[model samples]
Target chain A: MSDMSLATPRAYRRPSTRRIQVLALLTALVAGLILLTLSCGRGCLAPGDVFAALTGAPGADASFVVSELRLPRAVLGLVAGLSFGLGGVAFQVMLRNPLASPDIIGISASAGAAAVFAIVILSVDGWLVSLIAVVAGLGVALLIWTLSARRGAAGARLILIGIGISAMLDSITSYVLLEAPAWDRAEALRWLTGSLNGAQLTQAIPVAGALLIFGGLLAFTARDLEALRLGDDTAQALGVRADGTRLRVTLAAVGLVAIATAATGPIAFVAFLSGPIAARLLPGAKGLLLGAALVGAFLVIAGDFVGQFLLPARLPVGVVTGAVGAPFLLYLIIRANKNGGTL
Target chain B: MMRAERPHRFAGFAILLGLLVLTVGLSLTVGARAVPWDEVWAGLLGQIDSIGAAAVAVRVPRTALAVLAGGALGLAGAVMQGISRNPLADPGILGVNAGAALFVVIGIAWFDISGAQNFLWLGIAGAGLTAVFVYLVGATGQGGATPLKLTLAGTATSVAVSAFIIAVVLPRNDIAGSVQSWQVGGVGGARFDTLLPAVPFAVVGLLLSLASARVLNALALGEELATGLGQSVALGRLMAAAGAVVLCGTATALCGPIGFVGLVVPHLCRMIAGVDYKLVLPLSTLAGASMLGLSDVLGRVVARPNELDVGIVTAFVGAPFFIWTVRNNRMRGL
Candidate 1:
């Protein structure tokens, strides 16, 4: 055993050096993206004016735009993006599949469908719709989990089932939108496309809370997740209750994603893309929860900035992320295939 | 295996064909305006120029379009699954639907193109180009487009294409209302003249799909086994993929990119007819036509005065079945 261990020569870091370096880089990127999002919008404010507004100093027009509009929008993007990132990484590590993000697993689609149904059919507004969305997201995830568990909880079967459910939920959403009144059509489309347009400070409160709670739980379980990544039998041999850790991690991840969806209407591929990108940046990092969350935040803030200012016509954050993430997804697929790795 | 199964398979085919005829008849008889069987029969015989007969006459084109599109999709789907050797594969998984959608959106938003004929052309062009692009992207890589790689490539193309569609459609509210209905997949607004050009394409696709079954059978045994059998595995895959693209492109044009028929019907057929491509291909075609026709009929019944899109109804029907398929199969890797 000693000779085998010596021959293998597994590399170990203090978790201080590698993780901190990567985290610092992500922190810098997130800060920069937030600043860019705040400064670049319609009636664009100068950096000095934006910073002043953020600090609660008075500057009439700049203050109004920055405080009322850009602040909430940016804050929501930051919080929701972090939730998605953390939730996404949790699922990837737990399930051991890069494609096992919340959006791909029917959670986001079900949430979107419920929200659209509330908006178009029930005529419910604001908080009530968000409540329904969170419940529905959890309900759908539970359903997929139960159904896929019939054969044993293989990730491939779960993903296939999730894709099927997502497609069905999408059809339901499209049907509701089709029957919606003209007045509701634009609002529905905007929400469906996942915009930060018309974001309110009140909306950010629950999202931030969910992020804190679930993100904390996920951080606590990060060590277990790293062990789980070594395979279930090995994890159990290491004195980890593999199933318990997986359940706790998945529940927290689902909750985070549900709340994020309620806030941002399933912003395209933020969750789907963030963990993979974070892994690429911090190669061989354990768990990737923090890095992934930060990457998600960056994607959302930068995507929002680009959609609002870079394009000729204003687009949604979801659209920008989708456009950017899809090519990355393709590249990942190709690279994974070449390396004979399961995506 | 072939000789032993031939008699029983022929019997099953006969039953399916009979069901297809019944579905066609029901499709003619039921709609927004329910017409009596006698009047429909008279309309068929051209025995009367009555008002009810005119309604029956109108139903003919739509029903025919359903049959053509459904058969093409099912056949293409069977071929796709056989070639990819992945049960999850379907015609839409080839990037056809997304490509067609993108082009149609472009046509409406930028070129101001309208009318069914123009939409048909644009859809075909989009689907064909997207399929070719995905194939090239998947095939050029180190392992030459394994099932997983192809599926990923198709999904990525779909995501990017839909994003482009949203980007184009969002700012232009003028096209939103029309494009919304078109994107959902339907046969409600099809005209005989609009469907004319697609008929030849569908027919050719169907013929090629049927002819490629032997190749699919060999291909299904894995590339090494197929090559050992002295088959040009790459050429076979190319032919099968091309046939699928043509069938899928035509179907999308005729009926706004219907989902699940291509994905679901083939699986259903395989369950009844077993896994041989010879039985699966033809059975899928029959079952597909019947399924779409019946769904369209059900769509009319569900919403009463207001109709649900057949696409939505199929999803409602197919989702559970798809889940069941996944749950039952142990899903031996791709």
Candidate 2:
């Protein structure tokens, strides 16, 4: 409408992929990282010890450390990663804007804000946090959608509106945390930095189940999503029912993101990074859904490990991913700006 | 949105000044404690004998800081939009605040820097550098610094910077409390001693912005046309942006980064004073001060014993307004 043109640029992709080999390599690599996290902690354990601990072997010494401490945390990371990856890519694909990832746009902010409110004000815990986060995430999406839809060309407007909304929500989150009567370190850290320091095996269950249901929902619409990346007119011409596809995908993706955020506290930019990283890793791959999901898992396992060991002081996964993702995002923006907004 | 005739322009200024007077009054008298009018007057005269007088005394410097800082942010935001020709160009929205935060945070974490003057320079430097970086990044490729592109670039930078700050703060218990205020802006801790160092900087920045009004006007008519009219587009853009940076940098250094005053005030002023930078800039200053002063009062009153930060108050008020602006306007660039 003004000087800047919102001519939507399309990224080229299809179901075409390097296929199973790349996917297998990423899975195996992620598995190795998870195992590595299991082995190296306060005291190192051999792969032999880890294997026996997993199998409920007799006289397993580090069984609690393996099954309780490390195992649930790893499972939480892996499951939450998949949720973020799947959810993030779905939005980017549907919106055709990398910056439209849930984290940047305010869905994740809504969840984090809700989580903080629940913890500080309501003094709630467990599944209740998950429930509130999920509800808030969907509500924010609707809020952004309704507000942005008031104008012409909702694409760029939506993301910009979302950013504005996201800032507001973030301020609320910070304000509540600051005024929190009882300073709970873990509760504060979970909302502030997205940590896995106190992951419960119980927490992993609902998140994994969320990944399964919402991820499956996303997968069912995967083909239509591919058609979406080609833009709305072209997709409709190919009988893709663009609006229906967008609505369903958005709901499913928001659900995935909120549920995972409730469990892991919006693990900073995993959702933002996964799609683009996976697309690069498996070049020409359409429906980068599975690949991106796996990348999310890999990033969490690897990021948590780095935060735990590589850093000067042990940090949260969100902090590590945020630090890593920011530079990559800048690179993408710089390159895209140079290439006239192309990926 | 047409040019204001002479009479309407005069009326606009009068209305704005009157609004400022009202808000300043509200800020002085209304707070956690309801100070009577005579006591507020007595408090202004340095009498702190009564409880209401003492409460009024405590709020005076805070109110002063709110006015000055709010004016700086609002003026900065107007100049930002004027120079960039983007409606979305607020200090906070553009990630300049984040940049300032990054430098001040680094200074705190590594060097253990203290004092307002030290942070002022760091904040200005960071704000200036980030402004340049975001502009370059946004202005790259075919569409140069489109509103959407710039906003996105700023958003990404802000997100990245926040992560970095959290990382630095999380590990060290010592610096964490100090940085928390920087993360969340407020004037609750306002003191004249702290406020005094910032006044000269704020005045210079304010004058510099007001002085560049004609140059900003000339450049508004496309870069080449402004050059055709013997105006230096790059030089003018830089000068105006410098004033904005100084203003925002000083405000941020003083009160952390308060969002939305810069964003909301300029837009409101434009609605009142048209697109003319001279009218917009001054009007934004008054409106911003009024808004922040009133918000500070609201913050004090709303929660009773506890006070909400002015930054949080503005966020609640401004974000919806921002979203509304985005919705009503037809924007391009993704």
Candidate 3:
């Protein structure tokens, strides 16, 4: 083992340095994106005005736009984005399949479907919707888990089954939206894909709570998860319980994603894209949960800004991320195939 | 072996055709407003003096469209699965439906394109492009188009294309309502004139699909073996794929991207007809038509006063079967 460690010494030493640099860079990028989101909407606000408004511009128009409108929107984006990123990367790492992110594997789709059904059919509001989503999300994960547990590469089977499941869930969302009263459609559209358009500070609370609790659990298991990646037997030999780690990771990831999805719809591939980007940024790095979280936050905030201000027409943040994600998905598939489906 | 199997296959085909006829009858009679069985016969005979007869009159074109579109999608799916040699290959799963949808939406949005002819062309072009692109991306890897790789590529393309569609449709409220309903995949408002344009394409596609069954059987014995038996594997795959694309694009244009009719039908047919593509293809068409017709009838019956679309119904009905297939089959080397 010592000889093995010594032979690949550069793998450890090099990534340690790169991880710090990369995480720091991602943090800075996320911060910049948050600022950008806060400052721009219908009309761009100056940096001074944004800071001033955030501080105590109670009666001013800039203050309302910044504090009331933009602040909640930014907070939701930050929390939801981080959660999506963390959950996405954790699932990918746990499953050892790059394509097995929660968004692609029907977790987010089920959550979004639940949220839509709650809002449209049940006429539920706020936290109840999120609760339904989280439950439904876990239920779907369980269903897929039991269904795809045949002997073979469970990871590949999980993705295929998830695709089938997601198709059904997505169509449910559409059907609800279609049956939804005209007044509900504009809001229900967010459930089909994610959007931060009617941002509310209240919506961020449950999501942030999920982030803190689930995110903490994921961080605790990160080491064991990295060990499990080396192979289950090796992980077991190293005193790590593979099943325990998988269960914790699955719970945490599903919780994070369900809450985030309920708050801001599924947000279209933010969860799907974050982990791969983080992996690319810090190649050979083991624990990418934090880096992916930051990347997720960056993509959400930046995507929202692009949809709101960069494009001629105002679009949802999900649309922007979806556009970016599709090409990246293609690139990843081609690359993963070249490497025999291992990233 | 052939002699022994022929009787059973023919019996199975007869049953499916009988089911298809029953489904049409059910579709004609059962709806938000139920028509008497005797009245349905009169309605079919063009006596439209009463509401029941008029309702039956309304259902005639819808039933036809559903059958044709369902057959088209089911046949397309069988050909795709055959050519790709992957059970999961369907026009919807393989990005052809999405490709057709994106093109038709674009044509409506940008070119202000109208009429069935224009929609048909745009949809076919889009389906063809997506098919070619997915093939290039999926087939280029070391193993040449494995099922998993191709599926991933197709799913990604579908995801991306849909995002584009949402971006296009969101801003324009004028087109959004119409486009949104269309996207839900229904045969509700289907009319004879509007349905006519697709018949030619559907017939051509049907002929091509039926003709390719022998080629599919040949190709199914592994490419090298098929070639050894004097089959031009490339030509056969291309012709089959083209037929699938035309059928899928045409069906998508008419029905607005109904999924799973193709994916589930062929699998069910294979169970009934065995692995013989010749037997499976025709059975799939009949079975596909029956399934869609039943779905449409179920949609109308389940949600009275506010009918659900066949597309949504198929999705709900087919998804369980899809999960079952995944669980039962091996994902590798199939």
Tens digit per residue, CA lDDT, model 3, B1-334: 2332777888889899999999998988888997788778889999998889989999999999999999998999899999988878878877889999999999999889999998999988999899899878877656778777788888999989988998888887788888888888999998999999888998888888899988899988889999999988899888888899999999999989888999999988887778888888889889989999999999999888889999999999988887788777765533
TM-score (chain B only), all candidates: 0.88, 0.96, 0.96
Better of 2 and 3 by DockQ: 3
Model 1 residue B39 CA deviation in Å? 6.6
Give per-residue CA lDDT, model 3, range A240-321, as digits (tens): 9988998898899999999899889999899888888888888575658898999999999999888888898888999899
Tens digits of per-residue lDDT for model 1, A1-343: 7887677534342455767788898999899888877887666678888878888885455887888888899999999899888888888777788877888778888888987888778988777876787788878877888887754564567776787798799889888888775555555666776889889888888888888887888888888889988888999999999989988887788878877787788798898888888887774756478899999999988888889898999988899998988887777666664433532
Q: Candidate 2 on A1-343: residue-level lDDT in tens?
A: 4333345222222324355667889889988888888888877999999999999998999898999899998999999988999999888877777777999889999998998899789998888988899899989998888877643333677777888888899888887887886975434754576888889999888788888888888889998888877878999999999889988998899989998888888788999999888888775645389999999999988899899888898888888898889877776666664222422
Score every model by TM-score.
0.89, 0.94, 0.95
Looking at candidate 1 chain A, the ten consecutive residues that score lowest on lDDT are: A334-343
- Name the 10 consecutive residues with the lowest summed lDDT in model 2 chain A: A8-17
- Against the native complex, each candidate's DockQ, computed on alpha carbons, is 0.50, 0.50, 0.64
Model 1 alpha-carbon miss at residue A22, Å: 3.1
Fnat of candidate 3: 0.62
| Model 1 local distance difference test score | 0.80
The residue-by-residue lDDT of candidate 1 on B189-209, one tens digit each, is: 877888887777777778878
Model 3 CAPRI quality: medium
Give the least accurate 10-residue stretch of model 3 chain A, judged by summed lDDT. A334-343
